[model samples]
Target: MGTINDGNTHPGATLPWGMASALPHTKDFREKANGPAYYNFGDEKIYGFGNVNLSGLGCPVAGAVPLKLSTGKFDWDIENFASTYKDEEAYAGYYKVTLEKHQLVAEMTATTRSTIYNFTPQNDDKQPINLFLDLGANTSHRKGGSLKVVSPQLITGSQLDGAFCGFQKSTNIYFALEINQPNPQVKIYENQKVTDKREVKGDKAGVVWTLDQLDQGKLEVRVGISFVSEKNALDNLRKEQGDLSFEGIHQKAIAEWNKQLQKVDIETSSNDDEQIFYTALYHSLLLPHVISDVNGEYYSREIDKVLVADDYTRYSTYSLWDTYRTLHPLLALLYPKEQRDMVVTMLEMYKEWGWLPKWELFGYDTFVMVGDPAVPVISDTYLKGITDFDTELAIEAMLATAANTKKNPTRPGISQYIEHGYIPIDDRGGDPQKFSWTNGIVWGPVSTTLEYNLADYNIAQLANVLGKNELAKEYYRRSDSYKKLYDPKTTFFRPKLKNGNWMESFNPTDRFFDIRWEGSGGKGFVEGNAWQYNFFVPHAMNDLKSLMGEEVFLSKLNDLFSNGEYDLTNEPDITYPYLFNYVKGHEKKTQQLVREKGDLHFTNTPSGIPGNDDAGTLSAWLVFSQLGFFPDAPGIPTYQLTTPKFEKATIHLDDYVYNGQTIEIIKTGENDRYFNQFTIDGKVREEVYQLSHQELVSTNELVFNTVSERLSEVKE
Candidate 1:
């Protein structure tokens, strides 16, 4: 799931939310570590490792500094340094692999900020280990950097990388590399040009070293990275790994992962579902990663300055447009305190960046995807009872983005959306500053309008909770703007021209909206067709049903699945299966669709994930589905009930918030697919559609009386 579909998750040693990863780079037939993913099943030749990478994201994640090692001599040909290998093993915070050509065994362990590597070279000649520190080699575009050898055993440098999803946002990575061996000789390389100078700086710069001495017949290296500065990188390495042995650090990392995984435990009959479930859980927690240094300092790309976090730990890499759906809600459920800090991070981003994050990467607003997504994420968190931050400031930020018209970064066409009820397809105000919106640059006016409607819907949710009824009413009315885009002729939400005319000959399946005359054949739906985005109104489900009529809505939903319209790859319709619960007496369809999609798309292989993880966007969908509840409508803080894959699933809620309570879901009955009903702590539920956060944590158990194949008919 992490390796395929541009998930780009490297097989390496990295702590939970760790800034640095020790990734094993390979020289493959297509492309090796120089590509998005560091380790794939088909990759050949192991060329040592790189120090940092983005995990499970959909963009091209550049390698910070790749360290390639060989056992014999100094060579300018980096191609000759790699060796073919076997025997690979990976665990949390640890990875082990062997180089078959050189008979070398390499292992790595990671801290939150650094990755510690151990290499054992079984060279019959007992030659010194030769290593290359490539500052220039990157998986993505490398914008020239500088490197210096501070000492015989130490090297420090920085690499400038940017344009996540082709958005013009760059991050400067600084690293301090240390060799555990004593009496090491060094040289420099600038674009493969060798020099005796201890320092080098260029587009292709690196430091080569030969280590003659080793401890216990092993060569160990440590590299720490920071976005702030080289000094902070060195201090991060020293502060975390100081006075600790390799085993001690590895054990500490393992313990931390154990504690994290222990939050949710499951017992199930199907072994594959269990493996896939835990793997999904693991992938879900790897994003919105820690960006603050050990001393609580971080580089703010929004302001182009270094800022202090003061008290709370800062984090970045918010793929909010994707994560606000379920990843954050899951966090708000399992780890409210951590989720609180994440909310604080988002608020801080608004304060520093002048706008909330669209798809934030290291404090840089990539604005990769459409929508003011921070609205739903913060509102969802607050509605779930984790309100510790400034309520006024949050509301203020929401209002600013909701009202700001000209040069709006998050909401591109606010004034147009307000005047026309929905954004017009020809609105020039929708052009994004630095974003790749699939085929064309005329940002999905229809899709962006839907995103804005959802954002406004969530803003209303927050406003209602804050006791501002008039403000809530205004936003709620604004949220129903999706109704204007709904064309009665096609019965699907299609694009409308600014002149109050429908797009000529509307085709819902066309992915390219009628923008550029060349690509007008395809409907523009922001990486999807109108079919997928048609039923994406999760928040206004009842209103959507009212618009299309009850029977029409149900028939369209059935057509969506039977006619192969429900998309498993995109985010807009990921919650489609659970939509059945929104309509009464059709909850049985939700169960069947959930199980069928789970069986088809998710698996225990490299391509288990149907699409890009998008920083755990798809993985969170799987995690929630497997747990018998899906946050079908994000920002509503209500889980749509379904048949859990596991027989007995235990979700240990946050002790401080839930008062040491745990939500135990015990599913056992004649059928696994259809359940007659479920009971919460011995009380039967009249409604099967939703469960609130408060009611969920306030209970002890939810036992679903289940059935299988649904081979038997469901009893209404």
Candidate 2:
């Protein structure tokens, strides 16, 4: 659907999702979609408690209890006015504020190994009231955990019984404390697993839970968490705050964050960019939430794991190879029923772990980072139909984990990266696999095996659109082994050798940060590099512009989007500045290089994010370039348009869907890139118009003109 009859001749920027505008903090029902402790599920408020011991397992002693955040200044700048704190509170655990002149309380419990925080001061009465701990805040290594001050009158009640907190892998975590006092017993000792340059003496110890004896009124505390024993920390305090109190377990954790922020219903008028886009979509739905409870159960405690005892939903520390590109494709477009319960939690972690997770946390998969990137974010969210699972057992567990990570030759550097295209530099792929952090990332040093052959050619085009045509022609012949490590005399996409020759001092501007090895170890690789991943083989950008032509691939795609040294901060340079909308007339230079890279590379604060946002995969490329259309080529379903950040947008997919969309961005301001003119849904139409994905989930009407002078006239 395209159109235009205004003459200036640029009918290239397509975007129509009209009459939809709501998300301005869904109209202050406690305003939050951003700012104020980051993810404010519209403040129905439930600070934190991932698995405060419901026994379904999951607890490094998580807790963030701040519900209303004092209402305004974007909720006291989420602590910074109180002065600084968003380093994602240790994977979002520990945080408590009850001040009015200090009634403060903090508790982070664990101890299957380490991590313990217990700060209590009811009235400051007898005076010893200073308890503020950040301890390497948001972590860069405080290693384990500890803080003490116990003695509710020389400690009684069985010396504070079976204490608790949680977390074990990625260098353990634990915590414990007990007090029912008035106020006045102080001790502050934090041990990040010691070793302050070898002088180990008991490295550092704690558990002295004292606030003197403040009992000025109702000062009770007894938190718990455990892997097993300390009687599972009084059975996770009788399955979560038994006999509630602590404001009824912090109002049942703000009614479980208002039932996961009432699923989604935003409106928007700019209440501070809808509180930073709904608190970054509420910190992107609290880490693959529900790590298991409601009896599906959980508990893994890492190290050559086993024992994941589940019920149904068990998503642990899933960095899902960087939040399955664009935080699970915006949770399959605004939670399509939790994207069909996260593809039934990835076919229940490939039926209790046999191979699926490429970076799991907690219940251990920690194969940590790098492609196998959960197969192009679970096969482009089950081929955009967001399946309700068992889609032929999720395509035979992604064709048995991409044919066992491509025929496992003791996978680790994965069978010389599917029989050599690039991995070897000796020691079977040299020094810590060229340091994807000492053997973690096997490929992805600019052209991460072309993002693993374009996510194995979109998981073999979603196994031939679900029919599985012989496992989609054997993964489209292992996705055209990237034309056997293409070199065509250094056109780029290096690393090959084994007599093929290319590796030695190959410096494509040493984009690999430190010795060209890929993905983030090459800091700017997995996120960006080699001039934004050699214009990301966009399924071979026109066979790489016929070996560099069309005026040297449009001046190397306009200096890779106006070279201020491009790093739109991750996701292989997110469609590298909309690769001038697939070349042809250059669609008004892809709508003026996406509004000049969202106005000289974005800005809204907290370092207005730029790199390592691999969580919402760079905010799903700003929700598909603010909805103009751009899915360059993820197993080719269809999408390609430019310019859209809302002038009108309506997308209400529940209750028998309704799309009433609209986007009126025709700002040609004429600088010239591409787009001539035409019309559709009204018929004036022209060429180059790929839209599919069921005409973008059933469309309605779309319009655009924006040519600001440049029409020598050429209509067929």
Candidate 3:
């Protein structure tokens, strides 16, 4: 599922929340550089093994310090160094490939701090084996770097990479490589020139390790990466991989993955469906990685200093705008302690950087997406009883970010959003050539307004739970700002000028950047058209339905699927399939739509995923959908029920928070397309389509019975 065209997820080896990831590299294909380090189905020759990668991002980053192994004389031609492999395999915590050209088999696995590679020669060739450390190579734009041969068995270096989607500060990665054998000859080079000195620093600096003979059975290399310092990198290597055999590390990684995957146990008849479920679960838990070292020390790009985390494990790579919809809620159900730590980490980031992260990467705030997404993520976590952090402080941060109009990059148009109740399209002069509605600069005015309104609604929910009723009332009123953009004449949330006039000549079908003419199409939304964005009011579905009228809303909603206006590849329209639950007796359509979409988009092949994992948002949606229910609203504890894919499923809740109870969902009846009835702890539930999180975790069993008819007929 990770190798889809838009998924961009590499087949890599890493522990859950590991700082470093190891994946195969196909460097000859520069046009596909925006993709992952490895595309499982592509035929590009293997260039090297990339030690660090950002999974599922549209633009690649942090594929630094590629290590290539060969058994021939030194040649500077990178093209000649690559080898073709036939047999290849990858899973949650392991990857293996055969280098047919080199007659070698390579396998890789990782711990929290380091990745270990094992290479076995197929033939007994007397030629000397060489390991090349290409410091200049990276998936993103390289600024500069340095490499030094500290010892015969050790090489240390740092690389500076920048320009993630043309935005971000240069990230410095310090690395330490340790060879298993002692006294291997090392040579340093700079700008393609062999240097006699042990140190080399420049744009094209690299190092080569030459083993005298290849008669040995296998060779192992351990690499440790750190954002703080070289010494810390070495310490990390010793702590994670010191004297550990390659098999031992591989087993450890597998055990770790099994621990996370076993949270949800299912009884399924189809092996393909089983693989899909486990893979989706695997992808859902790979992000928001722990960035702190074993000693709780990390380098903060926001603060420009090394900081110590004494209480909690600091985490990075928060794709909050994509994750808050489903991923955070899933975490609260299965991994409450980790979710609490993540919330604490976000609070700490707010304390250090003055604002919560939007799209944080490698300790840098990229500000990649719109909205105050941290509000929804933290609010969801807090409302789900994962409140191990300071609630008052979190509320203060949310209020400050929500109310700020200037000097806050996270909330771009907060002042106008607060004052005018909507962000005007004409505020930045409606010029598509001079501006973008998707990037980080004055983009998606209407979309941002909607996102801000939803975020405010989430904050209000959290505030109400925290006993701040007055503050909650204020935020709740502000959340109704989405209504200002609704143009009753167009029957859509049309973009308006600063003078309170609708942008003329609008088309709901035109996507972002689809129309070139001035104000002809989507000038206010991000990545989607009006039809997709219209159904985005997850927090206030009843209100939206009322505004559009039930018949009009139902007609338009049905048209979204039949007319091919619905987009399943992005996050903005993911909630559309679940919206039918709000209208009574319409859930059968939801079930059919969800099942059909899931079958189309998800599979067991390399290109199984429908689109970008969006740092696991899409995967989480599938996981929750297959479970027969979904947390459609972020800050709300309720989950709207549907039809389960499996006949029976069990979700193991975090015992620390949920009193060691497990929610067992049993599907009874031959029909799996419609839900006829539901029961909790054997008590029949009539006319109720929602289950609270409290009720879910505390209950021993929740059963859904299916019938051959539609829900409306059953209700009648």
Off by over 4 Å in 3: 29-37, 429-440, 514-521, 709-716
Better of 1 and 2 by TM-score: 1
CA shift of 62, model 3, Å: 1.2
Q: What value of lDDT does candidate 2 attain over all alpha carbons?
A: 0.44
- TM-score of each candidate structure, all chains considered together: 0.95, 0.31, 0.96
Shift of residue 397 alpha carbon in model 2, Å? 7.7
Q: lDDT score, residue 90, model 2?
A: 21
Model 2, residue 60: distance off in Å is: 18
**Per-residue alpha-carbon lDDT of candidate 1 for residues 1-716, written as tens digits (9 for 90 to 100):** 55765566666788877888888776421122245566665567776587777777766665677888776677756666678878888887888888776567888998999888888876656777787887666665545578888887888889877766667667788999998777777888886788777677887677878876566788788998898999999999999999888888899989988888888999967778777888888888788888899999998987899999987888888888788988998888887888888889888888987777778887687777778899998998899888889888899989888998666767766788889987777663523443344323446778878888899999999999999999999999999889888986678888788998887777887765444334322454677778888797888898899999988888888888877878777788889888878777778888888988987889977778886787888888888898888887767877888888888889888775777788899987887777657899998898765788788989999989875554545312
- Identify the leading candidate in terms of lDDT: 3
Worst 10 residues of 1 by lDDT: 27-36
Q: How far out, in Å, is residue 40 in model 3?
A: 4.1
Candidate 1 accuracy as lDDT = 0.79
Per-residue lDDT of 1-716 in model 3, one digit per residue for the tens? Answer: 76756687778899887888888886632223444435556756788887877677666677876888777787767765699887888878899999887787999999988899988888777667888887767777654578777788888888877666557477788899988776677778888788898888886778988876632467788999888888888888889887778889889999999988999999999999999998888888888887888778998898899999998888888988899998889888988888888888888888888888888888888787688899998898888877778998899889778987667688776767877898887774335464432232546778888899889998899899988999999999999888889977777887888888899878787665532334333767777879889878788889999998887777778889989988787888897887877777677778878999999989988788988888888888999999988998888888988889999999887677887788898999768777778999999987557888888888989898887644335211
Q: How many backbone clashes does candidate 3 have?
A: 0
Which residue segments of model 2 deviate by more than 4 Å?
1-98, 105-115, 122-315, 321-355, 358-372, 375-452, 457-478, 481-552, 559-572, 575-716
Report the lDDT tens digits of candidate 2 across residue range 73-179: 12112232131222122212233433333334433332221123344544435543332222222111122233333343221111111111111233222223344
* Top candidate when judged by TM-score against the true structure: 3
Global lDDT of each model? 0.79, 0.44, 0.81
